[model samples]
Target: MHICFICDEYPPAPHGGSGSSYRDLSEGLVAQGHQVTVVGVYKNPQWHGGKGVDETINGVRVVRLPSSPSWLRYKLQTLSDRLKISRWLKCEHQKNPFDIIEASDYGGWLRFGGPAGVPTIVRIRGSNYFFDVELKRNGDPFEHKIEEAALARADFIGSVSRYASERTLDICKLSHRSCTVIHNAVDMDLFSPSPGVSRERGLIVFVNSINPKKGIEQLIDAMNVVCAKFPEAKLAVIGQDTQKPVDGITYVEKLKQRMKPEFLDRVIFTGRMDRYKGVLDYLRRAHICCYPSHMETFGIAAIEAMSIGKPTIFSETGPGPEVIEHGVSGLLCNPHDALDLADKIVAILSSDELAERLGTNARCRVETLFNKKHWVQRNVEFYERCISSNSHENGRCGCK
Candidate 1:
């Protein structure tokens, strides 16, 4: 089967959960003897060489398109990208056709609809509406309408988690649309535990964009408490420091201002690192991995850490519960409650027995359920179903 993915954040370039998830699925499908093409529209030409650039990475063909002139307004840029993406799909379909086209619900890139007869699936990797609601902010009305139109036009819809799907429906008031839940997965081969790699005794690794949404502030607050309890307890923050500077001070500096001076010395910030080399090495070295995000369609970062057999602490809010079975697989913390997060961290740091048990169980959970091979196969089945259903409908139309 030929599968085409419309993604903005494809890897080798900087990306988030959605792009990484699509990459895993795309590569897995290629390995299974399926043709996979990724159509990515970039806002910045620097992200991909100019425009209409084509390359094959790990057997999957990738086509990159520049959305619009960078100088244009944000809305205008998005509108242009939507039209270009639609045109690309139509032209590509005319040439060889795609069995199924899957797009992220991130920016409603398919608001104009996809190829003339292709079955399109808009996988909910969180939408603007969903994010606004989660973060308690008012989003642009135009974006919400565009996203709703995109979802409404999809032949089928899949979500990374039930929470994300349900919240999207409620937020969009899509009474008729039903979403199938398919959790995001990680590459176990690349993220597996290396028992020989000695773990840093009191090291806790936090991997994600250093923003308020990721509960970094809360994690910092918790670290203060955790450090006091275990003198050696330290945190190594790994990811992009996205926080904008305020009043001539950087966001990291602002965070430091609130920290206890003694505890401050232990925390280290390694801004944005390569996933394969930097992030993986840190995860392998850490005794514990924490992703206390306030929102996640599906917490892939936490799962990545868990897959590495490091005891993980995921947020109780959002889809963390679905990913981790509380005390069984990994620990869950109230992301908003600093004290609770601290206690959870302290519990894992204080007992090596519990950490090992949780870490072992966490690895088992990922291997058993969230395995990339397993989920990629599931995606193939789902795409086949969508394709067959579309064909049947077309047949009925011809008969009529």
Candidate 2:
């Protein structure tokens, strides 16, 4: 089946998890011998790629358009043309007339389908309502209203976690079909256990945007305690300030201002990692990893860390706690309690036997649950079902 995948983020222009997930899912679907077309906002500064129609990537033909004020308007903005979206929709219709349009997030592009005549499948990745919590925490406001319209109208809907599934219903007010939950997947091959170098000082790592929702503040506070006990303990923070780093708690300065003097010296910020392999190398080298997120639709980084056989710590708040049973595959802690996280970190680091046990369990879990084949196949089957239902409902086979 030919599927048209639409998202604002994708490979070579990634800013967050949705983009990362799209790249992996697209590649996996392609491997299953399905023809796929991707429509993404052009985000490259060097190529300045976006919406002016389309471009090609690997084997997937992509339509790139102007990105929003977040930057790069001249090359891809639909605002000035105003009627451009209709033109692009017509162009896409002429090209292949997508059998099913799968979107990320609820009701964003009203142009996709349903009453508009196309079978639209919307996948709700974490939403802007999530931004509301972070925004209020930082005294900010709405930023993605344009996308919100697209979400409200899609014919089919999905999310990566139950937390997201529940939140979508609450935000859309049960007006649309309830969301289907499909957990985000990881590349098990690239992330599996490897011989890694451990820090003699015992390092703890956190990968993800330095946003408050990720609970970086809490992680650092825990590190503060860890540092005091084991002054030799170091902290490495991956990812740049993708979301303004919680107003004042820049992971770098969070260490400087809030952390004790001795602990401050051990903190390192590998700002805005643009390279995945490099970050993975860092994960392999660390003794422990933690993501005490305020909320996680799916804790990809935490899982990725576990997949690499690094003993990881997940918060009791969102998807982290859900992914691993306490004291089984990975350790769980309060998302807000620094001391609790630090204590867990110390215990895991202090016991070689315990670390080996947790790390071994993590590897086995990913092989069983998150392998690329299982992740991709499940989503492909789900997409197939949506397409099949659309065909049956139209009173014709695969047509309007």
Candidate 3:
């Protein structure tokens, strides 16, 4: 089957979980003798400059369009992205028709499916309404409408987690729609236990952007208690800092300003590591990893840590419970409660036996459920159903 993924954050360039997951799936699809292409309008000017990029990496074709003009209004910019993507798809379809087009549900990019005459699957990575609720703010009504339209047009709908799908449907008032849950997976071969890299005794690592919703503030608060309990304890934040600051001061500086004087030097921010070169090595070296997100649709970073056989502490919120078995696979903490988070961190750090037990369980769980090979097959099966249903000229979605 021929498949095209519409996304802005494909790997080799900087990207989040969605991009990483798509790369794993796309590359896997190619390995299985399927044709796969990734088309996107990258935000980074340095990536493509004024011209579009057409290249093949590891058997997958990647086409990156130039960034939209930064000066346009937010809605106008979204329109520009939609038009550019639609035009490209239309042109590409005319040359050699794609079997299916899959796009993340962040923006209404798949709303152009009617023109391309290809069945589309909108995988809910994240939505504006979902983020607004996470951050406790009134979201843009226009963006909400855009998402509603896109979901309505999707020939099939999928989500990374049941929690994410349910929340998106409820918030978007599309509870009647049928959505499939396919957990985002990691490359088990690349992320398995690394005996060559010795683990640091008191080093705790956190991966994700420095943002409030990520529960970094709570992690910082927990670190204070952690540092006091174990004087040598230190936190290594391994992600990019947010472009804008929360108040006048940057988020990292704010975290520093709020830290206790004695443990001031304990927190280290290693801004955005390369996924292949840096993240795996960081996970391999860490004694324990934590992703205390206030609201995570799916915690890919947490799974990445778990894949590397780390004793991970994920938040009890959102899909954490679904992904992990609490005390079995990994520990779950109340991200909102600093003491609870600290206690979990302290538990794993204080006992080598407990850490090894949880780490072993964590790695096994990932291999059993979240391996890339399994997910890639699942995606192909799902896409085939979507394409098959579309060929029948039925008005309803395959998921329905």
Candidate 4:
């Protein structure tokens, strides 16, 4: 089967869950004897080679389209971007028609309805509408219209978690649309526990963008409480701040200001590390990983930590409860409650036996359910189903 992905983020261009997961899926599908092509947009074309560049990375063919700075002319820029992406996909389709075209829902790709008769599947990765609702922002009316149109036109839709799917429906009022929930998978071999990296005692790691939606402020507050009990406890923050500076202060600086001087010294910020190398290394070295996000599609960071056999704590909301058994595989805490998070942190820190048990259980759970191989297989089945359904509806196989 031939699969083509349209997304704005891909490795070496920008880092995010959608890009990383799509990369993993593409490579895994290729390994399984399926042909894959990816068409992605780069925010800064100059950072990467000038503009349109087609290359194969890790056996998957990738085409990178340069996007004009959207901030300068938001509406015009995105409209131009959509047209360019559509044209590229149509040209590629002429060469070797795709069996299925899967696009990330982030950039409103579904609005164009994809290449002619191709079965376009929009995989939900939290759209602007979902983000605005989560952050309590009054989003642009135009953006909401674009997202709703895309959702309506998409032949099929899939999301990393049921929570995300439900949220998208609630926001778009697409109660008639059927959304498939497929959890993100991790590369176990790459994230497996390493004896080479020495684990730091009483160390906690939080990996996500430095923003309020990620609940970083709440994590800091919880850390203050944790430090009151264990002075030596440390929190290492990883990931970039995509938000603009608040009140002339950077998000990182704001977090530092909120922390007590003594507790501040115990925290380390490694702002946006290389996902494969720096991120895995940090997870391997940490004693515990915490993802107290106020909103999440699937909590890929938490799953990556779990893959490394590190006991993780996630917010009780969203997909956390669904992914973890709470006290069996991992621990869960209320996203808005610092006291609850602090207590969970202390419990894991004080009991080495409990930590080990949770970590071991987490590793087992990932291996059985969240491994890359299983993810690719499920996607293959989904693609086949979509293709068969579309063909039946059209009275012929559309693929050339």
TM-score of each: 0.96, 0.85, 0.95, 0.94
Candidate 2 lDDT for residue 187: 81
lDDT of 3 by residue, 54-124 (tens): 89999999998986799998888888887888788878988878888888888777655633457788899
- The sequence of per-residue lDDT tens digits that candidate 1 reaches over residues 355-383 is 99999999999999888878988888888
Candidate 2: where are CA atoms >4 Å away? Answer: 42-53, 68-87, 110-117, 131-149, 196-201, 243-251, 395-400
lDDT of each: 0.87, 0.69, 0.87, 0.85
Sort by lDDT, top down from the best: 1, 3, 4, 2
Question: lDDT tens digits, residues 257-323, model 4?
Answer: 9888878899989988988789888899998999999878788888899999999999888778878
Is candidate 1 or 4 superior in lDDT?
Answer: 1
User: Cα deviation in Å at residue 396, candidate 4?
Assistant: 12
Model 4 whole-model lDDT (C-alpha atoms)? 0.85
**Segments of candidate 4 deviating more than 4 angstroms:** 68-72, 395-400
lDDT string for model 2 (38-133, tens) is 775553544344434566676677666664555535423444232343455557677677666676662244333322355777676766654454
| Off by more than 4 A, model 3 | 67-72, 114-116, 246-248, 395-400
RMSD of each: 2.2, 4.1, 2.2, 2.4
Residue 393 error, candidate 3, Å: 4.0
Model 1 spans > 4 angstroms off: 395-400
Q: What is candidate 3's local distance difference test score?
A: 0.87
Q: What's the residue-level lDDT of 155 in candidate 1? A: 81
In the predicted model 3, the residue pairs found to clash are: 239-272
